[model samples]
Target: MLRIAVPNKGSLSEPAVQLLKEAGYSQRRDGRALVHVDERNDVEFFYLRPRDVAVYVGQGIVDVGITGRDLLIDSGAPAIEHLELGFGGSTFRYAAPAGVAASVQDIHGKRVATSYPRLVTEHLAQFGVEADVVRLDGAVESSVRLGVADVVADVVSTGTTLRAAGLDIFGDPILKSEAVLIRDERSDAEKIAVLTGRLRGVLTARRFVLVDYDVPGDRLEEAIAVSPGFEAPTVTPLHGSDWQAVRVMVPRADINDIMDRLYAVGARAILATELLAVRV
Candidate 1:
């Protein structure tokens, strides 16, 4: 069976399990269960903390795993990103009490507290800013006020947490991170490929919707231009009329605007339908 690692808890957990379920895998109903086997898929899921996902993959204990990109980088693991899961997006940034620090340059010789010590250390090295790194498991924003560190490097989502701690973000984001599927070079190649394909299909299905419309034969080309799909729009001649029926898959985000454009070009009866699954 192919072995896989998944985040056991935190923000990445629910989404990871949900995506797996969507991709036709069986997940454990009990959150406390550490391991779940999907006999039909011939896959085993090992739930671990998000930070440890890369470690297990790199150590060849699991074939592949889902984890945050920042945690992967911080682990300095041999695993490489197999696929981007496209959720759990956040930025790693440096923060300090307002007016105390304003840029990356200010990090020099300062005590930097962070959960991801390796990531912060390497980032500081890029700027030749040598600082004492204080590694904390959580509540990094409070480090400055508690006098544990002069600056803190941690994941920032809405900046609400930092504001509550009397800290403000300084400089550009050090790193942009999102949940990704990571794989080990030593893992089973065939099984990993199969999983990758299923995930790609699910993500594509979520991103796009099917659109159908009718347009006069003369305006078919214009309608096609407005809603060209992954390859080409499907066109079928209408019965007993100078009209054609068009069908295409368009991005869900742009479906509304695309429909209006199609309508302006003489398209009628425009319809958008949800796609449950798609290979491409």
Candidate 2:
């Protein structure tokens, strides 16, 4: 059976679990359960801390795992990213009290506090600057105010928290992070491929919607140009009439605009439906 590691809690946890469930994997119903077995799928899930997910996969304790890109890099684990999960998006950056620091160079020889000490250290080294990296577990934004550090490097989802703490982000983002599927080099290739395929299906389903419409035969080319789908739109003749039925998958983000364009091209009976699952 393939063994998978899941984030037990934090921003990456719920979304990761939901994605697995959508991909037809068994997940723990209660938060207290550490291990979940899916006999039907021949797989087992081990719930661990988000940061530890990479460690387990890198050690070959789990065949694969899901975690954030920032956490994976901070851990310096041997595990490699198999797929980007497309959620839990955030940026890692250097922040200080207003104008206290303006650029990466200003951080040189200053005390830098962060939950991700390894990531902070490496980023500073790339700029040829050195600093005392003060590692803290949480509340990194408050570190400078509390007099523990001069600068803080942490995840920035919005500038709200930094503003509330009298801190402002400085320098370019150290890393753009999101939930990702990670795997060890020793994992079984066949099992990993199957799991990756299922998750890819779920991602595609979430991003697109199925559209159906009827268009006058003479205007078929115009309608197809408005919503040409993956590969091409499916066109079928409407029995005994000078009309055609068209089926296509369009990006969910542009559904409204596509519908308006189709209407302009003389297409009627246009309908858009959510996709529950897709393979391509």
Give candidate 1 regions above 4 Å deviation. Answer: none
| Residue ranges of candidate 2 with Cα displaced over 4 Å | none
TM-score of 2: 0.98
lDDT of each: 0.94, 0.93
For residues 1-280, what per-residue lDDT tens digits would candidate 1 score against the true structure? 9998999999999999999999999999899999999999999999998989999999999999999999999999999998999999999999999888898988888899999999999999999989999999999999999999999999998999998999989999999999999999988888888999999999999999999999999998888889989789999999999999999999999989999999999999999999877886
Superposing every Cα of model 2 onto the true structure, what RMSD results?
A: 0.8
Quality of model 1 by C-alpha lDDT? 0.94
lDDT of 2 by residue, 51-138 (tens): 8999999999999999999999999999999899899999998899877799999998999999999999999999999999999999
- Indicate the residue-level lDDT of 11 in model 2: 84
